[model samples]
Target: MKDHVKKILDELLARFDCLRGCEKEIVTAYQLMEECYTHGGKVLICGNGGSQADADHIVGELMKGFLLKRPVSREYATQLGRDFEDGAYLAANLQGALPAISLGNHNALLTAFSNDVAPDMGFAQQVFGYGKKGDVLIGLTTSGNSGNVVNAAKIAKSLGVSVVSITGAGGGKIAALSDSAIQLPATETYLVQELTLPVYHALCAMIETHFFACS
Candidate 1:
């Protein structure tokens, strides 16, 4: 890890002592995501209820600038200017993005799949369609046993995609199935969710710093 990115992880651990025991797993998850992006792979995320909102939140941070400007390279900007009359404007406005998709955000597909197929298979189906080798799947379930998220993890693994799971203490079945799992110390749904926000925020910040930090 780069020094700046490692600083972000260090700050997170210092602030959340409850996460002390989880440092190793958290770093592992970050490495999995870092490698995925390095190899030109996108991320697929899934969860349910509040966790579903968290999934969208993560996508929001990743697909756009979280802690850096993320401007496109000068070469790419120049190409844009040469391509069209409004290319200058486009190039000036466009920000580099980290590719990400939230499986629970598609209402139409979720409803259709849940109605015609099994409810627990919605995320799994999306994973099947969007996942491939070298990609990463992030499953956020407080109990670590949400059926849809767990099923999605299963499909992700079968497709050779790495899985990172964030759950409450015990790690649950998803933890066992994932490539890396960060189980927060708290067990109550709300408590776990509370800690989850900081953890992912730290992960996102570290990743953004790694890729876009200004020299």
Candidate 2:
């Protein structure tokens, strides 16, 4: 039992170490997210398959509180006084929700765009309609070459949204279109997807923390 526990701990530590190595990229993403929130812009995320799941997961974390204890505003604290054990709810609600939209969530629109316009233009068309200057468009692709994501990145660039891409090393067209990119060292698609999940989770947590601290 002791040996098993030790092995698990070691693996967890290694994963954390890997995360630390990607610290700069994560910080950059956090800063971008903060800027968008401060300027009243939304985060638009899109991807395919497992990367699509990653996009939605990131939005989920940012839309709600993570592990940190929620913070209460002075108004709530004054009203609740010593009975502020319920302050967590007030704090959670007080922290304004950052706007985020997962492009992968709209199946009907996506299918319509894909069928009528072009498969590659599905995400791009959405961007053309919804994206604005100063918004952040996050494109996720294990291969970094999904046609839809690449087109979306291009549309984002044209609309002046800062494009950020999370992809495997040697990311192709999507990387080329992005303003900045977080490239996982893994070459295998599955490994890249596995690695991307936690990185974006950390990014979301960091962004929320920064927003809470500043606002």
Candidate 3:
């Protein structure tokens, strides 16, 4: 476990009593991602509208440096320079990354899949295509009932992928489907989303600290 993992959650609890009683769920989510990355599995995220942007934002933080500077090892740096013409430049600039993909970002495929098949099945299709055993799918929906996100959760479950959710006051359909659901104590959609940012930010920081600290 990362040293800062517990610290981050503790900080959240100090700042937000509304998050009381949900510490375990939040911790479970961090553990799930930690396990997935440790086992060489990636995270797949999906949502709709604002949630879609959240999913993308998560990928942005994870697929590159967030808190710590994940410098390339000397061996890998040498290998990069040996392998390609611009390898040294690439090596100098690139940071170690956690494998993560925003399922909602493939605009072309999303459109084609929605048009060619079931519209609500877009997320499900992405889950089926990208998910593998041990991978984690994080479905974000304020209402917890987004059809596409729910469908994706269902598929992820069938395929032995771990499902974690971030939703509002009530853990909706997605909560039932998830292995762990961190439900914020907010009824309004925007408030729920407002709280979600900190929760995920904590998790992302913990995961990054876990992987890059010793390296």
Whole-model Cα lDDT per candidate?
Answer: 0.91, 0.77, 0.91
lDDT of 3 by residue, 110-206 (tens): 9999999989999899899999999999999999999999999999999999999999978899999999898889979899889888888888989
What lDDT would candidate 1 get against the real structure? 0.91
Select the stronger candidate by TM-score from 1 and 3.
1
Top-TM-score structure, candidate number: 1
All candidates' TM-scores?
0.97, 0.79, 0.96
Better of 2 and 3 by TM-score: 3
lDDT of 2 by residue, 43-75 (tens): 999999888888888887776666454455677
What residue runs in model 1 are displaced by over 4 Å at the alpha carbon?
none
Clashing pairs in 3: none
Range of the 10 consecutive residues with the lowest summed lDDT in candidate 2? 1-10
lDDT of 3: 0.91
> What tens-digit string does per-residue lDDT give for candidate 1 at 32-63?
98999999999999998899899999999999
Please report how far candidate 1 places residue 94 from its true position, in Å: 1.1
Rank by lDDT, highest first. 3, 1, 2
Q: What does candidate 2 score in Cα RMSD to the true structure?
A: 7.2
